[model samples]
Target: MATSRALAQAPPAPARRGQHPGIALTVIAATQLMVVLDITIVNIALPHIQQALNFNTTDLSWVINAYTLTFGGLLLLGGRTGDILGRRRVFIAGVLVFALASLLAGVAQSSAWLLAARSLQGLGGAIASPTALALIATNFREGPERNRAFGVFSAVAGAGGAIGLLLGGMLTSWLSWRWVFFVNVPIGIAIALLAPLYINESERHPGRFDLVGAFTATVGMVSLVFGFIRAAEHGWTDSVTLLSFSLAVVLLAAFVLNERRAPQPITPLHLLRDRNRSGAYGLMLCVAAAMFSIFFFVTLFVQDILGFSPLRAGFAFLPISVAIIAAAQFAARNQVRYGPKPFLVTGSLLVLGGVVWAAQTGITTTYVGGVLGPTLLFGLGMGSIFVPVMLTAVSHVAPHETGAATGMLNTTQQVGGSLGLSILVTVYGTASRNEARQQLGAFLHQATPQQLVEFRATGRLPAPYSSQVLVHGISSAFQMGLVFAALAVLIAVFVIKVRPAPAPVSPSGEGA
Candidate 1:
């Protein structure tokens, strides 16, 4: 195994080019879009999945977490496999596996069965995503064409969450919730068949799997996330919670140590040495943490507090999709000219402002006044930051290692999102608990003995107290998000050094 830096700096003697670039681009990007969208597409259908499968309400979260954890954990390993084997071969294999898993999930008779199938789909996604991105880099020249492709890619990446909400709602409303999984069957089949015709295989390299490093990193991330989520559900002082955090620290430390010595490391430590890439990764993690919470809490706020139906709540997210697409297009077209650093700076600040604005929302707040403006700002900020960071992540990489580089980028986003969500949940849960305690104390002084007994029996506070508690919890979560966004701005200003993309190299090993 080679370090990402060496792999990126090296070039093939004769670049691999296939016929019909347009067709190739379509097949590759479409496949990538499908993989990205699957992350959130099933969220809306979770209640349905739970009801049908007879799952406990709390356990239903596993339906999503099982997929996310496996996919994010195995991403680097999958990318490394693509580099050692052929990307085309791995891509087709992933599609086949994903389709099979989708079929299994659609027809699952029990919660355990569904969870297993979802994990399988995630495994396939781990394989497919990085390869699809690398294939795009291989097919298109590095300039306007690639940038345009990346713009579309980034747009879809940002829009995929909103699309999933929309599509999940439609599928659950008109058809059965299972149709959400079933819908992927045809698309996966089409991409599997079409990809071979247009996309050429990447050249293979002899590499060893970094099993030690892989284990440490994956287990560490999973444990850390579990700790935070458990703390949110249970109290922070839970013994299991403390144990999980302890394990995470040890495992993560081991991962760093293993990477220092591994001959063929799964994640090349040198990649972290680049200031621009590091800045991009840090900022992406921060915003993504906030973004995941937004999707989670906003949906709850719309449906639970505002009395919107599920379908209506889903549709309400459309503005985010539209704003993200427009902003992504603009940023993709103009970033190289003006520089990525500026967009990163301004975009992060916008995200911070949006989080602050969103923190002000209450039960009495109107949708247009309280929700739409912040959502638009959030979408635009996401669009502006995502495109440039994606470009920076894979920019200047040599042809051979593009898959691994891009894989690391996608993995960071996934892991970061998961970890961030858990942390925000903890913050929200703490605030809610504090508010509930205060409300209980106040009610004790004012209420009759019978009313107090009724309140204790129901574990319910007064309406005003309940509303204030919910708002405080949500506001606390947003404040944490604001910190993440602010930290991103700091990284962009001080860490990343803006510079020009390297001049294109010709097929004959000379500068174009």
Candidate 2:
């Protein structure tokens, strides 16, 4: 109970001032970067992995999904575990496990082996990530020092996707796709070694762990995500799709009901009782869904349509990475003064605008004119939105629940992104197929074998006409993103309410 009480208390004052704080911050930030980057690092390598392992198309996505589902699902448990066990102990253990899993994945010769490794990696990440964040929370005071640290933290979080893409491209291009996982080994080892030396362990909570809540939530989310992803590839009306949805409904319903009864629930039911926190979670869900789906589709468009080399496609996202980091830094500094409402509202609106711009892109449209502007806007908007939303989510929570609060925020982001994107895949499929049907309508009756072949290759009518429909399908998917962003803005303005106050100095001195 004392450990739990300690968790509920404000972080202890920094020990032995001077340069040690800076070193500690750097180490934590680097570890955070590695964990975040893993979310997307395997994306660019998917095709290569599939080729190497001879995996079926449907099974290929599992390589990525396995990690995300486990990571998101187990986050609460991991966070709570850190409260029970020492944060530094859990963090170091997680790093070692993650590194081992990476090695397993890199050396895997079969799809099954690789998938197993990915799942293990997810478990490691789930444990490590929350502990790392909590360690940061405990180590730094909640003023300028913490704020600056959070800024650097947010930057890494935002930039990780781009870094993953870049790294994946390089690994897949110059060496082997497996190198993507292989590279994590040494970095992880270094971090693991430094963690104990640099980071002090948090006081451990001796209270009962919420195993029941953890099981229900994890299984429920995994089932729910699996069902949605299945629906995307298979028709929504398929028997498997129906069963998946039905199972998800039952499991998640059970999770909710079970949580209501559990003592020290992994995700405290009270967290959702707050309207502001609820709105933050909703905002995260909607925005992440739109943003991540865009990444998925845009990757395909660049590679298949624009014929960009892997590395070039990776680098193309650099502007977005830059815009996001810059905007996040600005938002973190001014959030307290402006209040999160304005930033959330403006950010979502900008995201909507970006989605609209992206919707208008065509095969003939240059990346500069078509993708760049929207990407910039989307990045800037997301950068502004996430920091404040994250801050707001935890602002009013008691200290013991900080891990739970952070886990809930991350869970919403990860699960929402996965589930939302799966749903959007259906939108994309519908748009593409309908366009293909329209384009090939006349040719269906009078087509030669060659003409039909050509039509199939482009998935549309020939030449000038085909480009319009192909672009239209892509645009339609982006239009869906626009709608989601618009909805997020409305929610942020109307739903998320926080009292106005002057901005605080960032925890680190950079923002001050």
Q: For this target, which candidate reaches the highest lDDT against the unseen true structure? A: 1
TM-score per candidate: 0.91, 0.91
Candidate 1 lDDT, 1-512, residue by residue in tens: 35643543344333235667777777777777777778777888888887898999778988888888888888888888778776787888888888889999999999999999999998999899888877767677668787887888888888888888888888888899998899889999998888777787777676777889878988898999999989998887999999999999999999999989998888887888888887778888888888887787787778767777767878989999998899888988886577687788778888877888888877687779988888889998888888788888876666666777888888888898889888988999999899889987888889988888889899888777788788788878888888877887788778878765555678999976
* Stretches > 4 Å off in candidate 1: 1-19, 442-457, 462-464, 500-512
Question: In angstroms, what RMSD does candidate 2 have relative to the true structure?
Answer: 4.2
What is the lDDT of every predicted structure here?
0.82, 0.80
Instruction: Report the Cα lDDT for residue 103, model 2.
Output: 98
